[model samples]
Target: MAILRGNPGEIIKIWHGGIAIHGGLIGGFIAGVIVCKVKNLNPFQIGDIVAPSIILAQGIGRWGNFMNHEAHGGPVSRAFLEQLHLPNFIIENMYINGQYYHPTFLYESIWDVAGFIILVNIRKHLKLGETFFLYLTWYSIGRFFIEGLRTDSLMLTSNIRVAQLVSILLILISISLIVYRRIKYNPPLYSKVGALPWPTKKVK
Candidate 1:
């Protein structure tokens, strides 16, 4: 609406808003729920299984931002990123004010990929539903710090950083859910035969 009101200037302002990403997350969650229902799988279990994959995918997707060169730091010389020996394709394409910017996207992508690998490898040791919580908590923790370094960040009415606020909230929610589930279900710390009251134990 603002863009159509003869205000091209407002377009960049609106584009900088985090509404699209926020909505995308909500939509992704809904889709996950639907997929779980269709598969007759436990929602939390499915979430845990998919969490790492989602992060991995996001890592790959971050390259898109790097290509655009829009999500970068305030200012930096090309030599800085070039010293890192980034791909020539990325170096040639990404620029701001005739200088290379901080590779925020690459940083985030590497972070996400590493986090996903760690989570995936350790997932079996985690309690049910706990993996998802940990994924959320860990990812948000990194994001909170990373968002602080970025030149572009969405803001609330009070000019508070929206991504930072959301990251904190997610971290809190993840911790709360993990604690709540531990208290409520009291599942076994380790898997044992017939540990759960379900299928009968087989006779030797």
Candidate 2:
């Protein structure tokens, strides 16, 4: 936007931290609390349902990158894509400078869609909060790789790719949590603990 404003030389520093990222997490947590309170559902079970939807939405949202013509990698050529048997849409729309650039957004969308499908199908068997953690893990893993390929990325003062760094950390944390829970709890989907409660349990 700043560049479009005829100030192409001007550099705008946008604050990326604070309540923005965590707001979604907090909102998800609050929604889980509300669903568990009203429907008598397990918080983890609610997370299982919500986590897939989040990924699906993210995948759908990534198309905005194509429309904006931003977030694409260095540069590429149409002939190269055609020779490699790449999709026509990509070959036609994404090539530049005789080199094929990485479509970071497309890669992320595909990864998110795949992750959503896997998480949704297996959500029922996951322990409470496991699906949420899985969402973070899977999304972060893709983000770390994709961020590295993106031409435009948020950076820290030390010239580090902030998103990639955070994504790597989240991936590690999610993996550790999943492994620890799998080893410690070993929860089953059909267990009495996981099942929806009987109606006779009256509201307080």
Candidate 3:
């Protein structure tokens, strides 16, 4: 933070505020919802199309946290990492301040990348919003456990991680929405005529 650094002259310091993924997600979600409402579009449908991309982005983004040496987990031993059979580069990075830490960022990145692959392939077989909901469910499930390992996570209390809490809520909400939409609307398939399910259905 610029304020925290006492206004360091370096340009990087001017913008070196700490990471806030949830803030970005919330802001983007709100903005996307507003835009969808204005355009009379179904947000979930749009989300279905974009969900894989979002996860892929998130997967790549965690590497940034790695570069910053933040968002890592508790300390471990080099032998511990060797037991896990991690690559030399990863094993080396885990060593910080004479201690090896869990490569939580790598764990999450791998989870998200895998999710992206699964979601992209499965979208065609899924209902309109299920792709997005599935994305949320998958990501949140991984994030819930991964956040548990993170040492720098935001905390509601000494024992409660903010990301883990949010992840749990997201998983529940996403699954709920998927089940509700499936039963209530019987929505069109993502692989069908179009993502604009309501409009396209009436048009043709």
Candidate 4:
């Protein structure tokens, strides 16, 4: 928006004015890594342990977004929402600017919950950090599609949505990390990693 308005400088000025979820996640991940280093704990194991909870938190957080009436999709019709079998109050709250909008928050919340269930179910079987990789892959896949429906997405260009771009990158990174871990790291399984002592003395 700043660039479009002939004031690219406003980009930096407006940056501190709002929070982005992707940035928040990256910040949290970095913090987790640093804490793990300081405590001499296994970061990937910790990530695996928290995977389900993280996704569940994301699912719940969308409710807050819903309450704020932000992050909705483009204009939709009352009948369209009705066809989705949404609850009456929810259908009513979607009405904004004299028109109904798609309940994207609801969509993503459902997606996140589904991911949470999957992660929890498979948590015991995955390799250390694979659950976290799966978390990233799953969330990115869902976000890539859901972001298309959002009316307020950050854009890298008029044609490139920032969230979508990040989602793609994360998806690739997750896959690459999984393969690299298996081929190079040959790390312990999620079920076994927790039994290992702290300062396993290796990042793996």
Candidate 5:
């Protein structure tokens, strides 16, 4: 409705199309909190377990943007894309309307995949509940720059990209929380309790 600059009746149009990942993340967090409360689960532990999987899902989800031909950056040369050494199929899809655009979707997906790898590798070494902060920090770092390259970003102001702004804020907050937790608890990366990736511990 806001993007369309439309009235109340036209607000329904949003149902037909648009969705924002930021909004989804916020909603998911709220839902997670509720579920964690009900289940008597430690939210931080759950967050650590879900961190890598979140990025993995994001990596897979970016393909949807590709299929829809949305979330792409502005025009670029085929030569530029080729120089990046992207796959042949991606090169072909980029060749739309006699021009190639920056494959922002692919860039984000690859970044997410890399983040997943980093998170999984370091997860066991992280303190009791730091993986979630790491996830936020890693994701926001890439998104801050990538959102700048995107032409289709939602705007909070004339010069401000909404996602970029959120990413920046998240990066600061995530890093701050990680520092605070580490100082307070000084936990080792290796966990004696909790399953790999799931954070479930065996009963004594």
Candidate 6:
């Protein structure tokens, strides 16, 4: 981005130029669409199968932020964090630079882990094309609030957190798509599509 903007003054000097998860998601979706189109496949159905793993990856990826000591919240008391009953190692790690901070990265990682578990368990029940949207809804719900706790969030303005804004939009869009699909098709949300045990037949 710094090179594209032709200005290095405002760019944060991070390896790989400060990558954002949302940007990667958008890029992946576009590539998935193109590939699925060429392959004559239903993009949403493929996305459904891939969604749980995506969150699982997110759960594991957050530790990178932990190691880097970024994406943490404001100063907090040891007593306050201790009340949460977190493990000693985590508590000790949170005590960085002589101050304890909320482990926002850990919070997000746990949220993503829970999401992955729930998605995997409920996946067979969701109709084709619905699981992916459910993933978006579930993830955004957590990301919306989690992003609030982060001091390093990307911002569009002084008061506007970019990830929170994207989360809100994704939540709305995913919910709308789910509702529309339910009303229009009335498909069995809890039943498998057919004998194939997968909905690769068509976009229906």
- The candidate maximizing TM-score is 4
lDDT of 5 by residue, 54-166 (tens): 99999899999888777889999989999999999998897777888999999999999999999999888787668888888889999999888887888878999989989
Q: Estimate each model's TM-score.
A: 0.76, 0.69, 0.85, 0.91, 0.86, 0.86
Query: The CA-based lDDT of model 3 is what?
Result: 0.82
- Residue 103, candidate 4: C-alpha displacement in angstroms: 0.3
CA displacement after TM-score superposition, residue 197 of candidate 6 (Å): 10
- CA lDDT, candidate 6, residue 202: 57
- Per-residue lDDT tens digits for candidate 3, residues 1-204, read 335357556424425665466666777889998987777777777788789999999999999877877789998888988998888988898788888899999999999999999998889999887898888889989999988887877777778887888888888898898888778878878888373334522210
Q: What CA RMSD would you report for each candidate?
A: 6.7, 6.7, 5.0, 2.6, 3.9, 3.4
Query: Model 2's lDDT to the true fold?
Result: 0.70
- What would the per-residue lDDT of candidate 6 be over residues 1-204, giving only the tens digit for each residue? 336379665344435476688877887999999988887776776788799999999999999988888889888999989999999888888888999999998898999999999998988888877889988998899999988988788778789998999999999999998889888976555435533344455565
Candidate 2 lDDT, 43-157, residue by residue in tens = 6555665788988998887887776676787665556556767678866667554456767677888999999999878776666667888899888888888877777776664
Against the reference, the lDDT scores of all candidates come to 0.72, 0.70, 0.82, 0.90, 0.82, 0.84
Model 5 regions more than 4 Å off: 1-14, 185-190, 195-204
lDDT comparing candidate 5 with the true structure: 0.82
lDDT for position 19 in model 1:
48
For model 2, the superposed segments whose C-alpha errors exceed 4 Å read 1-41, 95-100, 180-204
lDDT of 1 at 121: 86
Looking at candidate 1, the ten consecutive residues that score lowest on lDDT are 195-204
Model 6: lDDT of residue 12: 47
Model 1 pairs whose backbones collide: none
Q: Which candidate is the best by lDDT?
A: 4
Q: How does model 4 fare in lDDT?
A: 0.90
Candidate 4 residue spans exceeding 4 A from truth: 1-17, 195-199
Better of 1 and 3 by TM-score: 3
